[model samples]
Target: MDFKEKFSTIKKHLLTGTSHMIPFIVAGGILFSLAVMLNPEGAATPETGWLGDLASIGSAGLTLFVPVLGGYIAYSIADKPGLAPGMIGAYLASQVGAGFLGGIVAGFIAGYVVKALKKIKLPISLKSLGSIFLYPLFGTLITGGIIVWVIGTPISAIMEGLTGWLNSLSDAGKVPLASILGAMTAFDMGGPINKVATLFAQTQVDTLPYLMGGSRSSYLYTTNWNGNCNIVSSKKI
Candidate 1:
């Protein structure tokens, strides 16, 4: 296809692709967030209560099975042609903790890569080469490599580093930190403040798991107390 034609096709794909995935993204994110809220190690852990079960279910939807969402999105953009490999690509991305971002990236990569692969001109009969070894071979290698080496590793590092820093703060610092997070969350109605607190909590989860017996509960309690303080600050306003 000519440049104009390719641009038009790509534009059409982008619109269709984004439209297909947006709902899943929103739903999955909401479900994941709700799961986190319900699972808070507060009055009851997610292991027992009704809310805990509900949270588990929601979290399960986005867990290792997230490829289904990416697959469907690709199917919407590239039709039936994109479904199989799109799922494959998404599964690989999720393995490295890319979560939703990985899923979306995989969907776009699989759809467009397959679309472009189909358009490649060759002297040999594409019918034989195309199905036999083209799409799966090239698509999987490219998408998998990009995610494993380029995208996934660096993002995972940042996530790890952020969590590490939060865990390193002294005990006295936690409540203040949590308070700041709570204030931020409540102030923005759960946008920025929620992010800060959630980041700290996630960090705690990673690091506090190593604490023996009593230290675990104590550390968790302080963080929650601080978070409540921040929320109270917002309420006071």
Candidate 2:
């Protein structure tokens, strides 16, 4: 196909596949964020505690499926032809800690590589070689090299920065911060006061994912407010 046709195909693939996957990414992101917020101690492993375990569970969703996004993006761009190698490249990207950005790079690279390979004017015997050997071999090599050399370091650094910021929020700000959090939690009963407290807690969680592990203890406490509100409503009823 001409350049315009190729570009259009690429665009269609991205829009379609992403439309299917965006919900998963968003849910995964928010859950990951909440897990961090609720269990601020960062839960590097699943053994930290119940809250840590829960947070870890949420984080797994984000981590494990990073490659699926790329696979689908390639499939969207190149159809069934691109799925296998695209997914393979995506998985490789995840293995190197490139995350979704790496996945996208892998997917697009694999997709275009597959498309370009398909266009080669070859005899029937060589066609099989191109399909079975050439496409995957070349796609993987290109995708892997880019992910490892160009993408992995930057992405890993960002992840480290985010985690570090979260860990640092506990230095000397714990007590007064906790009081503000507690008071805010108690004041509005899930209204403005509750929102303020939630925001404060989230800020702490964002900055100290590994220190403010008390965030989840408040879940039960927050539920108490809901029960209390229910009782007040019953009285009015």
Candidate 3:
């Protein structure tokens, strides 16, 4: 395929993965937000009963986000055969602190590896085993190994460096960064650019709460602005 075709194919795969992952993100994000809103005063501990339970469930769902994304991405690429390995690799990526970017890498790796495995010729007797046993087993091992040993370290390092850099930035420096992120979020609403910016903010929430807060506030502002404008326009007509 030519450059454009290759780019399009890659975009398609990524979008497929992202599309499948959205429901999980939406559900988890809503639950998480609700939990936080319910406990805004920070007075409720995990022992606080129903509120705590809801918070825990939300947290668990959020944790599964990366694995689901990776698994679906692989499934998009290589069907059911890629599902197990992709989830395993993505889980490892999360454990190793590589975050969503690493999950994306792991998904692609699992998909391609499984696709390659399918090309191997085995005896008729062994062929049945390939799909049921061998593919998931070996594919997971290889994918998890690569993610943990090869990809994980560099990604963690980069995340740390980025976090540190962002933290070190002066208020003036942060303005430009925040502006770009806000603009990206506002540019397309729920489109790819908006999703990308939102994901970046979500991933950084733990280490850089302010950045995520800024991005989210900007998003809310833009959304409200658009809604109000629509209402006014409708009234004029």
Q: What is the TM-score of each candidate against the true structure?
A: 0.46, 0.48, 0.78
Question: How does each model score on lDDT?
Answer: 0.55, 0.58, 0.74
Worst 10 residues of 1 by lDDT: 212-221
Ranking by lDDT: 3, 2, 1
Q: What is candidate 3's lDDT per residue for 1-237, written digit by digit as tens?
A: 899888677667777777776677667656666666678566333436677777777667678878988897888888888999999998999899888888888999999999899899989999989987888888899999999889898987776776666676635577767766766666665556776776777655434545655455333333364456321121110
Query: Cα RMSD to native, each candidate?
Result: 11.2, 12.0, 5.9
lDDT of 2 by residue, 103-166 (tens): 6677887777777767778787777777667766776676667767777677657655654553
Instruction: Assess candidate 1 and give its lDDT.
Output: 0.55
> What lDDT score goes with residue 31 in model 1?
61
Clash counts per candidate, in order, are: 3, 9, 0
lDDT of 1 by residue, 13-106 (tens): 4445444544543454456556556665753336666766765655554453447655765665556657766777777777886654566677
What is the TM-score (0 to 1) of candidate 1?
Answer: 0.46
Which candidate leads in TM-score?
A: 3
Residue-level error in angstroms, candidate 2, position 83: 2.1
The candidate that achieves the highest lDDT relative to the unseen native structure? 3
The true-versus-predicted C-alpha distance at residue 189 of model 3, in Å, is 7.9
